[model samples]
Target: MVSKVNSQTKPRSRFRSRNKLSIKEIFMWLIIIVLFVGMLKVTTLLAKTYQENQHPDSEVYGVWQEKDVAPYAAEQLIFTQDGVVFEGGVIDTNFYFDGKYLEYQHGDTLRRFKFLNKDLTEMKMLLSSGYQPVFQMSEKFQNNIR
Candidate 1:
């Protein structure tokens, strides 16, 4: 007797399928990339705005003493946003003179100076005129003193 076999009853393997991506997964990845790029642009703009507000004005004022004279010469220095003005000069360089009010504009701040003779009486007059006495000396004056 011969045995009979049926080929149509055989089962297929589970790994034999098409490898494809779903539409939903592709859409999710695109959204993530766009959000990252937008965040970077916003951060850059914020940094620029902060830098612009930090600097108020470029002008500055200060006092320096001269080096050549016996007594240092009182110096009133002014620096503009672009450059310097009145490089060097003596305040009340000659004999004791009544203090006079010195006025100038630097950026937004207003600066005033008053020169007085060695005598204390003259210095009082400057004080009454809204000018503050910054320095006092009795000997010869020098440049770059301070």
Candidate 2:
């Protein structure tokens, strides 16, 4: 009868060890999960901030012309709130702006420009030919167009 009792106790102990979790273990797992969630939240917030910084501001809307040129000879850049008009053509979508630069997406093409002034009155178009054409804001659009 003693041997039978020992064998039954051994099986019960093994079952409890295999099936039950200690409080300390549960607490550790909970901490890990919380840390993971916190990390995810931080990552998401960082991503959102980065995305927000990529868009241009309302100050960029204006009529820009090539700097130091005659009025008739100056090339024009007309920027609306949504897009830009260049070379008599309009690109009405896919615009991105960081604090100092603007990016435009054309069909299979990407154009970049760098701002030269704090007021965003001057900018330079970045081109592959090592030609950075300077443009200066000639006219600004108000919130109301009359």
Steric clashes per prediction: 12, 0
Error of 1 at 109 (Å): 36
RMSD of each predicted structure:
19.2, 6.8
lDDT of 2 at 143: 53
- Top TM-score: which candidate number? 2
User: What ranges in model 2 sit over 4 Å off?
Assistant: 1-56, 69-73, 144-146
TM-score of each: 0.27, 0.59
Q: What would the per-residue lDDT of candidate 2 be over residues 1-146, giving only the tens digit for each residue?
A: 99999988898888878897889999999999999999999999998688666643566777888987787888897777657787878865546777688888766778788999888889998998966789988888765131
Tens-digit lDDT string for candidate 1 (1-146) = 12323333232332333245568878888888999999999988886466445422221122323324355444434333333344453322212111243344445544444545323212221334564445433232223232
Give all candidates' CA lDDT scores. 0.39, 0.79
Q: After superposition, how far is residue 106 of candidate 1 from its true place, in Å?
A: 28
